[model samples]
Target: MTAPIALHGSNISYFTGKLENYFRVKGLDYTLHAMKFPGDGKRIERELGVYQMPVLQLADGRWMTDSTKIIQWFETEQPTPALIPANPAVAFICYLLEDYADEWLWRPAMHYRWYYDEGAHFAGRHLADEHLGSLPVPGALKRAFMRHRQRSGYTRGDGITADAVAGVEAIFLRLLEQLETIFRSRPFLLGERPTLADIGFSGPFFRHFALDPVPLEVIRQRAPAVLEWVARLWNTRASDCTGSEPDSVPTDLGPLLEAIGNEYLPYLNANVAAVAAGKKRFDADIGGVGYRGARYSRYRVWCLAELRRQFEVLPEAARADVQALLQQHGCWEPLWQEKLLPLLPGQDEGLPFRASTKMVGANETV
Candidate 1:
């Protein structure tokens, strides 16, 4: 037997939980270990050229980063009981949903986790004990530092000001309702079986939405079916599933696509504009919410570029179908809104092995 993969990251981290869910469902042998801060961060930077969660260390001593790229690499190595659908159009949709879940939902997920006192306190204490226990600082100080750092970098500092709080929370609530409707009828996002779409969403749901106190209560009270999906996905193993792969995207998923069209793509366009203007922060009114001083991300600029690249690689027929679908939901215009994406040289070219930029700030120690 081969040595178990060494998965290093915080137990409660969003991306770590996402990779853990994928590894569990794929039946890959792995062991989870807390990424000791300061030390681990420096080491990971040396190995992967970036400090990020859920870095996978192979038996041969190879290190991997970026949960999305890591999963894609694994899927290529093991295609049976596929996590990504086989059909081209369906697979494209899965990729789209995955990207939406990764970049768009992150705002609300971060807001819910760090904006509320209930969530901040819970996560702060857990992270303090899990990732910072070896430190000589007092536990209370560690917890306090965690809370302050998270709020500073992720929630308030990122753009969830008091005025934007309700709007951010509404995003999560609306998501729960949409997902509840979908999960009420099917066991997975695409169909009766799990797919890349489910795995992508697992990033937010498995760790933040389902684990955070305030959002967990809201989920229990408003969208119990979604709550059940959180547990069901964690318990599911893809090798055991006998369900047929979905040949097409479901109609119920139109709402989610519509949300991406209306809310997410426009935001990406705004970010693209911000990056082009060489601004570190820019304010934009997204989904009727006026956000001031929202930090711009070059990484998200690459996300939009990557989405277009995926579309470009699809077959002719699949591209036609995808074009219609995206157009139907108002995604086509903004998706191609930036005629020339301001991509930095070699940006994101070394994914899974190296990183040119991070999803957010790179100074997150704990």
Candidate 2:
């Protein structure tokens, strides 16, 4: 008998949307358990050793965290209808692009949802109040819940300001322009078929840009073709494509990863920093990478180190290709290295990539 696949997530979550798209694209059999804000869902997630949702509770009882990890797992467990391309170079590029969409694109998406949209702003607060009502707390609990939500970096409710909203809008428009250039010639980001890049990007494009009324209007007005592509990707069913999986790095794939690490990754990081720091406004030009106006504390260092480690593990030839790509993309210089500090010892070293081997006797509380 097959093990059960359960997903714990909320509908309002972009990450959850990404996971759901993976399930649909992979034709995986699963159940989605909707969770209320500030609920026991996080406690269940902690017990299972997963940090965040859309967690995949595997049949053997092991849990998987992060949408990217879960999608990779699906590629291994069900090889048909491959989300990744057969060519290593193309596949690596697709993965890197997907990472950009998932990580950097999030800043603008969050800013819009929590800060710009009045309906979402109040609704989120109300949702928090309802979730906290389940507890036996006394007076001023609602205010406390609001404060807690503000502090939790995961919440989309607190990181809003007029400047932030403008930044998000700028990022969105820039991404659309880049995507239009990429997709105008090809149906997918790669060439012919939908790759992991398409699936990965579909989540944000669907939820924040395509669905959100304000951003959607902006996308429609500025880049209708990009919006069209978003629709095309979402409407696709897994059964429509010829399925095949790329499990190992192909020799030719080195250049792609190298390009991503050297050029795209650095660009992305810098762009994010600009937004967080308010050094640069979030516009089409600023959409490359880096969180502006945001601090590069422990969490930022940990994430960057993990990414570097993943890049380091690539074949030496692949590393060279990445270096070359970075140079080509004009990303050879280190711009934000001064602001970044090293992570504390014993911090969580969670890379976005993982192997498919299933461990027996893993916990599954959530």
Candidate 3:
């Protein structure tokens, strides 16, 4: 038989852990290859056009980057033990929550990995040793540089300032509490089986928050059940249980959704504005702390666009229910209000987009 598909990423990566654990849960046969970073031809920038980890190379040699997209690819191939729900409302909620976990949770994950002296040192050592091992650079030099680079990047990237510590900490603690509450009853975020929602949350929880030495201790102390779920995601198989039910989003998931709306939406709004304004970065206040994001992100904009598109196609009753739930959790306005507009005509508009009005315009296209 052909070898299982290859996941080119390191264990220390957030999305890597997300997809790695997901493949196991889905019962897909896959092999893990440590991704080489910086000047390595094995997974170079020209191939991916970006420096990112956790790309899945398919059997025919096509590379699939972006964690959410990869999960969708699996959905098409498997379809049983489905990662997304059948109910339009629940499925759409999974899309938004998955987007939340994929994009927004990166802040806390990065903060934990790089903000502290111990965590930074620990992560830097692992990153350099793993990804930079075969490079011409000296081990000590690369390790120190990696340490400084990641910490500085995270600090500036996520607005991890001294004053921002409390807010970030609050998010981490609340997430742990909510996961514990939900997992105490159900096996996964959505219901009886693992879904996109579980994989989404597992991204940060498995690698950074739960696995990192510093945050792992915090998790163990405050919410050990969260850790158990992470382990379960890594160890369980699709056949282990049936899956999430149709037409339902668990009541316990409300806190998780509320946190997503409370925290992630604001940052997403700023990024959307930045994409529209043709600026590389935008300012926003998250957790009451001011931050200037490093740059605009097209993928995240696409995530919002995809959610809106999915919501638009749902049946009327389902749409209304989903919108109401979003409103209750504080997620409706931004997504519903500012739609992703068309690409700039005759060019790859390097910029992201938001519709000028409610309707898709003559210039509009996904």
Candidate 4:
């Protein structure tokens, strides 16, 4: 018998919650280990060359990093109870949503945690203690520093400032409303079964919305449907397991799709252009608010390239469907552009094109 896959991460981590939830839903043979920061530093750094969590150790002993890359491996290897949509256009939409949720929502997610004092104190202290409770430093100091780091990173690096806060809050409010409305109709984001899109959302939804104190209060009060959906995903069994209908998108999910087109895609397009222009700093007009000073992210830049590549490879009918869906929701242009977005080929070793199959030649099981 093969060994169980080893997942190293913490519940406090957003991406970690995502991978953990997915594993439970699939009943995959895996064991979870808390990522020890100070104690396990050497091994963690050696495997990833950076302190990244939710590392997956394949049964054969090969290791992998990056949540999306790991999910892509599962999509290719374990076809049963598929998280990815088989329809090319639907699959493309899933990938796009995954990318946006993974890369774009980092700012809002970080902001919500740090903006309100209640959440700020809870998450800040909780995370620092969970990861570094064993460290010699006082817990209060670590919390204070982490709180500052989380807040400033968004304020300084992701361009979240006084001017942009309103727009970001607008996104949060609209998202809560839209998701609540969808949940009123269906259990999962797409339909019955949880798709990669649902998992994408779970990164923020589970960690921030469901867990954080302030947002949790907001979710419980303002969006009970949202809370209900969260509870559903947490359970091993859910009421809506009918799965998505073939070649279809859920009508209830239109608002989210629209938001993606209107808000997130604009920033992505601007970032894509910025990366191509070889600029050190990038600027964007998000929701009519001007945001500047965030440096280009090689990982996000690669996300755009990866998405366009997926779109480019779709079949004619599938391409037509994707175009129509995106166009209807005001998201066609950025992705529909003729020129491929630039990718960081040499500079980026963070996320690979795919998992390594060379070492396990003639066999692909994880």
- For residue 74, what is the lDDT in candidate 1? 87
lDDT of 4 by residue, 65-126 (tens): 67887788776777667788787877888888887787767667777788888888988888
Q: Would you list the clashing residue pairs of candidate 4? A: none
The CA lDDT at 186 in model 4 is: 78
lDDT, each prediction? 0.87, 0.56, 0.73, 0.72
Alpha-carbon TM-score of each model against the true structure: 0.97, 0.70, 0.88, 0.88
Best lDDT goes to which candidate? 1
Candidate 4 residue spans exceeding 4 A from truth: 237-246, 337-340, 346-366
* lDDT per residue as tens, model 1, 73-120: 989987776999889999999989998898888888888888888899
| C-alpha lDDT of residue 323 in model 1 | 97
The sequence of per-residue lDDT tens digits that candidate 3 reaches over residues 170-277 is 888888888889878877787777778888888888888987778899988888778888888888887777554756877787888777676777676676777788
Candidate 2 minimal-lDDT segment of 10 residues? 357-366
List of clashing residue pairs for candidate 3: 342-365
